[model samples]
Target: MSAHAMKMLNTLLPALVAVFSASTFAGEAQIELKEGAGRDTVMANCAMCHSIDYIQMNSLFMKRTDWQATVDKMVNVMGAPISQDDISVILDYLTTYYGVE
Candidate 1:
């Protein structure tokens, strides 16, 4: 190859490797949520906007009211298309499985 071609390959190769490596790592970093009655609904709805890992991260301190407020914010403020029925199930699951006192 020409020297110019070699130099371009050297410049782009690291960037290409980094991009692929990051994507591979991200794909493998999924959070497996605890199984529950509303697990499927929460997975389907919540993951539409943010990582489901947020639930696990906050479970240590979140209460029923906190989950309710968060869901309200998601619906009223963020325009998440969660049906009323799904909201009830999701709240129940979150509060029962993840809530604190």
Candidate 2:
């Protein structure tokens, strides 16, 4: 192959690799939750102590008060140490999307 052609191939190869890598990472940036999947943040933050599925499934049948109580327990009893902003987001998600239906 010509020297110029080899040089072009090397440059193009790196560009192609970078493009593909960026595209792959774009898809993996973050998992976007639906309106009701607010508990996802909770799971991400609180799952250190237990299974996230346990929280997800249980929240499905809870009332707003139940959710508040559960959040309180996680903060006060379990000592999950979540931020107030995150706590509000999680509680809103549970009450709006995961509450008893």
Model 2 residue 44 CA deviation (Å) reads 2.2
lDDT of candidates 1 onward, in order: 0.92, 0.74
Q: What lDDT score is found at residue 19 in candidate 1? A: 100
By TM-score, the best candidate is 1
Would you list the clashing residue pairs of candidate 1? none
Q: Please give each candidate's TM-score.
A: 0.73, 0.55
| Model number with the top lDDT | 1
Encode model 2's per-residue lDDT on 1-101: one tens digit a residue. Answer: 99999999998999999999898667545533444555567667666676455555776679988988988998899898888889888888877866785
Candidate 1, position 11, lDDT:
100
Candidate 1's clash total is 0
lDDT of 1 by residue, 13-100 (tens): 9999999989865964877878979999998999888877788889999999999999999999999999999999999999999999
All-Cα superposition RMSD per candidate: 5.6, 10.8
lDDT of 1 at 92: 96
